[model samples]
Target: MALKPLGFYQRLQQLTLPAQQAFMAALCERQLPNYALYAQTTGCGDTHALKAVLDLVWEQLSVRGASIDFARQAEKLVECEPPADDDSFGARRALDVVVSLFSLLDTLRGEAPEAVLDVSRTSRAGVRAFIELTEGEEDAQRLALLIRDHPLTDDENGFQDAVLDAVSQPLNKALLKDVRRLGKNDGVSNLGLSLE
Candidate 1:
């Protein structure tokens, strides 16, 4: 049976592939290995395992009618550690944003929870970042800086470089492919995730 396209589903399908990929890639880079980084983060506000927090965010928001405010959503994203306040700020900031993201995902998943995994770019950036950070290569960071310089152009080989570089990671294959798939199918909704 064919399912009708949901409104939000239509929007998700419409996002530009490169733009979405870049955003997802950046978001993925900021993730932590676990909550352990929290206490160790000290003033960086790394309290609580990051992955755990993200998990919590997911759990809390998978309810009905939940959604995030897109305007603040991007700014509210946790990219830096929280400032000192006797309590850990980084974890708090991360958690807060996750709460919003959770709502967003929940709203999106309301119609099709299963599709979430099949089409999620949420973890894309974190996975890539984890590899780069773990590898601890100067080139990785340099490449990131270069990306900043060359925004939205696949011609510079930067986007190609990103895919090639991240290809080594297990998660990157799906993430990159999904990004490309998303771009191509912009504005079109398929009942199944299949591109064709």
Candidate 2:
């Protein structure tokens, strides 16, 4: 059976963990090793690890939604240390992954308001903890600064493209191709549902 075109929000909700992970892998420019680490660390057993991360993101969004200061949360994100077992490059580029995730979420904000709010509702602490586990070396910090400085584009495609352009890694580019493919009218059918 083939998956049909549902809107982004609906599609997101309908996707299984492996599918969601593939979506995230494409969206976040993640490679296999790091992707596995994220899955393992975040507990991708019955659920998507990124979904849990989204919940943490929702926590920050909720605070921001209240028209309050969320700088403290941002500060905490930078302070986090990557997990020791994660020699994965994804851990090294954790900041980039996070920025991409937030950018992607922000793009779909209007179309999936309830999911956004609900997903973002989980405590920021979990995401923050994950951020810490990422490699926070100087290069990662510098890239993070670049991401932070760049303005988020108005449209989803534009934002995704801009992020992809900003990070010139082969894996990221490959994954983004999938991301773009998934965003199209009948993109869902193209997804590689099996977990790697």
Candidate 3:
């Protein structure tokens, strides 16, 4: 027999806390390295930069308990709902970061496979740092050595700009496209929150 449909809220409800936290953790893990690269290249070396998104997701999921559901919160985000209180600011930022990163990920997946490889390679040290932070791997010295050994020389600046520029517009366009798509699809999409 055909199954009945499930709305986004219903789907989220079906996810036990372990499953929800696991999904959130995986989402956080997926971006750790690339964001580490972005932070380092942009000269923001603080590891907290890497944790920002994860912290927000945790706040939404754990701190808020089951009340602040991901789909409901995401709906608020898609609808551009104003912050109901101080904490909502964190929620908004969390939504923006996830949506933006997810869009960039899509672009990297479909358009610039080479960039994805380059990111993986270039982010080696940062990834190690991330691992050390999250997993207690004790690789700080190695991460430092890796960074010091390969400073961005003058000759590489042009290549760096070329690589970065190629993805800039596409990233922005993807974010806009997703916002529009998610906004249009909210409450009506075939796959519910999974449509994101």
Q: In model 1, which runs have C-alpha deviations exceeding 4 angstroms?
A: 1-36, 39-119, 140-196
TM-score of each: 0.26, 0.26, 0.26
Q: Please say which candidate is ahead in TM-score: 1 or 3.
A: 1
lDDT (C-alpha, whole model) for all candidates? 0.36, 0.37, 0.35
- Candidate 3 global CA lDDT score: 0.35
Considering every candidate listed, which one attains the maximal lDDT?
A: 2
How does candidate 1 score on lDDT? 0.36
Indicate which candidate wins on TM-score: 1
| Pairs of residues at least 3 apart in sequence or in different chains that clash in candidate 3 | none
Candidate 1: tens digits of C-alpha lDDT, residues 132-169: 44445577667676444432222212433343334324
Clashes of each: 11, 10, 0
Distance from true location, Cα of 178 in model 1, Å: 24
Q: What is the lDDT of residue 179 in candidate 2?
A: 50
At residue 29, give the lDDT of candidate 3.
40
